[model samples]
Target: MNGAGCGSCHSAPGVWPEGEVGPSLDSFAQQTLIAGRLPNRADILADYVRNAPKYVPQSGMPAMPLTEEEARDVAAYLYTLGRR
Candidate 1:
């Protein structure tokens, strides 16, 4: 999650200071779709977060500059949200 700056746009219950730009990501794991377009599975999420416009044409999220490995790591972390 380092250097991805996800906290700059999204807010979670205990992740960081609340972000004012985008929607809260607190219940990301339980979400059914990514950016309201693609499936919420890990592989799709990793790719979507890495390149948002590729999946959601109207997404406000810019493409994240994460590597393949880093995107997977971010996906893994997102899956742990709202479970505890």
Candidate 2:
């Protein structure tokens, strides 16, 4: 997610800048829901990360420009948080 700018809003372990705008994603894998709404399933999370506004209309998270594959990759990585 180099240019995707996820780190600009969320703070994930090892992700630079440690953003404070959005919720921290350090324990994302343990979370049961995405943005406190949708189920935290892999496919759903992937799409949501790419287009958060679609899932949560009032959310501050903007739509990412990543492709399907890149979004999937990002979701997969996010699912690994706090598992180590």
Q: What tens digits encode model 1's per-residue C-alpha lDDT throughout 1-84?
A: 535677778887665656668777888888998877688998898998889887777768889999999999989988988865
TM-score of predicted model 1? 0.87
Error of 2 at 16 (Å): 0.7
Residues 1-79 of candidate 2 have per-residue lDDT tens digits of 5468888878988888778899999998999999998999999999998899998999899998999999999999988
TM-score of each: 0.87, 0.94
In terms of lDDT, the best-performing candidate is 2
Q: Give, for candidate 2, the lowest lDDT window spanning 10 residues.
A: 1-10
Candidates' C-alpha lDDT: 0.81, 0.89
